[model samples]
Target: MKKYQPFLLTILLLALFPALAKSEVPIQKGERLNLSRCVETALRNHPVVQGARDTIRIGESRIGQAQANYYPQVNWQTDYTRINRSRTGNSTYSDYNSSVVLSQTLYDFGKTKTSVNIEKLTTDSFRQDLHRAETEIVYGVKSAYFSLLQAEKNRDVAVETVAQFQHHLTQAKGFFEVGTKPKFDVTKAEVDLSNAVLNRIRAENDLRIARVGLVNALGIPSAPEFSLDDSPLFQKEKIDLADALERAYRNRPDLQSIGKKVEAADESIKLARKGYYPYVTGSAGYGYSGEDFPLRDGWNVGALLNVPLFSGFQTRYAVEEAKASLDVLRANEASLRQTIRLEVEQALSNLREAQERTEATRVAVRQAEENAELANGRYDAGVGNPIEVTDALVSLSNARTAYIAALTDCRIAQAGLEKSIGKRD
Candidate 1:
């Protein structure tokens, strides 16, 4: 009976805590985030992207507020008062009034229209800003993805190097035991093997850090341990400088945002200049006023005109400020044009340099591998020294490292070029 009770308790516990029985690391089940998916995740989760999207909403709200000026305003009011006209006997009486008033702007010399246009342009500018943010996140994710891939490749190379050194160490010891190699050969091989182990450890640490960077880029703090799909190796892409510059000029969202701002500023200038003209408004009211209910009733309607004769130079200063603001935007547009040109030149140069480096290192990797293989064969055949093998191994390791670096650089530079040209999400 006691054994059955214990078994029943265990069953209850398992039923209550089923998740506790699951494996912690079961076959690496995690999402495989490709480049496009990574970019999508970043755009969805990144704070900057979210904030930019919120800015568009804010701009929309502003546009609504500006359009509100085009509509009529209405209000209700009631008042009660006691008055003595001459301080005589029975001279005080109660007066009651209630009214519903309506007011509408009949004309304002296009001020309301200009304001609405400015708000609309502002919203467009914010939209462009959002686009720019999305573009930036896309590039950021690509760069980080490439870096992680490079780290993984480097780690693999380190593992291979370690294994090769271990093989060389075993061979050296065997030769020493057979009296074919000296003790010095075995000692040198041991040192090289130890160095390779250290390098492997460093490479592994780098891979972990790279993974963290990729997660940060994805903006997923709690992302699972996932593998990335390897991007294709770099191929030389021929991009014309003139065409790239043109694309940047046409496609850059930041530039477009500034252009919208300039247009808004032009509207602001017109809005400010409207202060010089007269404003005319129409109003109407319907009311009942008496000491008691249903005593008297009447309605009134009228129009009012206001001229800005003197405002302490406010209009003058506002016009000056608007003109100055427009000038500033124009200057910024010019500066941005220069900046775009420089970015295009720099990206083109970097892409060209990376392409050249990758090609050179690709050949170097093949040659170094051959050299290392030859050295290993000679030593194994008792025709070479341990020093030759160690040197060749180191050369091969360095060559592989350079090749990986070049590949990463090329990929990162390509992403940079895409960003500089304002590739849309």
Candidate 2:
């Protein structure tokens, strides 16, 4: 029981960790997060995504205003006038008038249709913008997740290196007592052990920073004692190259977003051109205006047409502005398509390289393990020098680091591919 004191203390401290206020949401400390869950959490919680959602609602509301032409416009008014008693032949009489007026456009020369089209197109552009935000969140979360994993592995390596040097120091001290070696080896080992301890601290700090990034991505607080659960991130299925390319061309959100923007700009040009045509509208109003004719309250109906002969050429300038915008968006869209292809190409290339490296690194890790074991056996048998053992350990460390790096590179490449191709979830 005495030997378990530290373990018990650690458990007690963990139990004392503060929990979050939201019960439906997990207390963040000790939470296990993977790419999918992290992305989902971010999409649901990130402030940027929420702001984008608000913009979508704004677009939706504006669509109603653009479509309001299809419905009648109603106006209400009430007024009272007091006149000199002799002016209108009525004395001390309240001259009050109240009326409701309604007007509607029975027809317009494509202005209403084009305006509605532009608003709908604008809404579609925002839909793509939301997709872009979601994709960005996924990529950011993944990068932070991988960084944390690497930091953990680095920490483990540092600890193992420290233990190796401590063992070396112990062996040197024993050999020196037996009068078989000098004090220099022991001093060198102590120095290496101290450096390894420093390395371990740095790695731990790196992990903390990475955790902070992940917390930010998830819109949660940092400083959680979270355990990792990445069982899902490694789930893989082969993607047909042609299908991937097709999907990239079709579904890449940023590109689709640009495409929608170009369409919206085109719609704007049409909307602007609509002002060049005459606007024909039908209108009707009914009220009471009785001087003395049967104390009459009655109905009236009429129609009107509006044509803009000139207005400082504002409408003409607007058309030119819309056309210029259309031209610019078209050029930008062409550039975007090329950019998408380049990304797809680069991600494909990196993934292939990482895949090959993974296989190579797997073989290297195995060979290094064998070498380290042989070195250890030889050292115990007094047939190996300290330098040989250190070299073998170093080789093992390099192999392990390389293997982890290969896997990390593969995962990062996969993420880039996913983003390039717009693979949702």
Candidate 3:
């Protein structure tokens, strides 16, 4: 992925362009990707998303390990020993014993249960982590997608404005040839026309950069050309900040992950506490010991209970460690909740402010258009200086650009708000 300085101080920017955004190529006619398609493809193919999937699978594999402790352990042993005693006068004997001994923990006061619970919680935590990763990827994709769209639209506007300025420049020169307009007017007109061409060139470059950004966001191989499906992001909708914040708290996958972490820590505390209790085990075995040709058979079964008398305060320290882990998780959860609240509030404000700015900028564009027309008429009728016309033209172009910026801001803010809400995929 190409990186660029973030002039917008937001989530999107790039360098290194495909330069083929508008180039003629036989597009392979792949399925056009919208937000949903981008998200689906990213979930399936993105490295981060795939890595998260692997973690969840590991979590699943660990459940088997957690359950394996419940099964009995059986084994066989065989050994031969040579005995020589001075009293026996150099006599030697061989003894061998072989048997299958099965041993299982009868009880540990819910230790296994607690451990299983912790493992299950860990599995759930990773699932939420996957969801969080997918959410972030979605935001990245949306930002790049909208950026490309806006750049293309801006390029179209720049091209049209250049054509208009060139027509005006031609009219200015024709008037000059007739010995009516002054040379200064023709020079100013040419300068404006060149500026318009410069704007078009810049817009074209920007569009290419935006295309590179989209390609990176999609996490696909570098492509010469890619087309996104046309899908408008805007829709009129009412937002209830209160409800949204509440839902975000419940649904945000990162928070849910912390909650699971806390649960696992709690279970760990229980498992550690189990160390203070007695460990009970049941065992059964059958074996034969022979000193001669005939075989001696024997069988034994017993229950063993072991109480931790003292282990240099190991159990106590382990329980304390578990408690400390839980405390850390609780503190982290509190901090995370506060951060989520701030993000949601900021994104909401940005969206509403962008909405207002879009309206104001729309009016500004109309005003700038009127001002440009008035200046043009005044200049043509010999009541305005060429400088005044140039100023008005510059103002008009700036107003149009600002209007586009406001629209782009509104769309991006909306996407960001959805991210903050955590209901987005």
Best by TM-score: 1
Give the 10-residue window scoring lowest on summed lDDT in candidate 3: 8-17
Better of 1 and 3 by lDDT: 1
Cα lDDT, all candidates:
0.89, 0.77, 0.82
Please say which candidate is ahead in TM-score: 1 or 3.
Answer: 1
lDDT of 1 by residue, 2-92 (tens): 8799899999999998777753422134866677778877888888899999999999999999888799999898899888868477577
TM-score for each of the candidates? 0.89, 0.84, 0.83
Error of 1 at 308 (Å): 1.2
* 2 against 3, candidate with superior lDDT: 3
Model 3 lDDT tens row, 1-425: 23544554333322333444423432234545576776666566678888999999999889878887799989898788777776878778877777889999898898877888899999999999998988888888888888887888788888978876786787688878998788877898888889899999999999999988877776764544656764554543457689779988989999999999999999999899888899899999998889765769899999999999888999899999999999999999999999999999998898889889889988999999999899889867767777777788778878888877877788788778778878656
State residue 236's C-alpha deviation in candidate 3, in Å.
3.7
Candidate 2 has its poorest 10 consecutive residues by lDDT at 18-27
Candidate 3 residue pairs in clash (backbone atoms < 3 Å)? none
User: How far off is residue 361 in model 3, in Å?
Assistant: 0.6
Candidate 2 lDDT at 325 equals 91
lDDT of 2 by residue, 59-137 (tens): 9998999889999998875566655677667565546555778899877788888888878888888888988888888
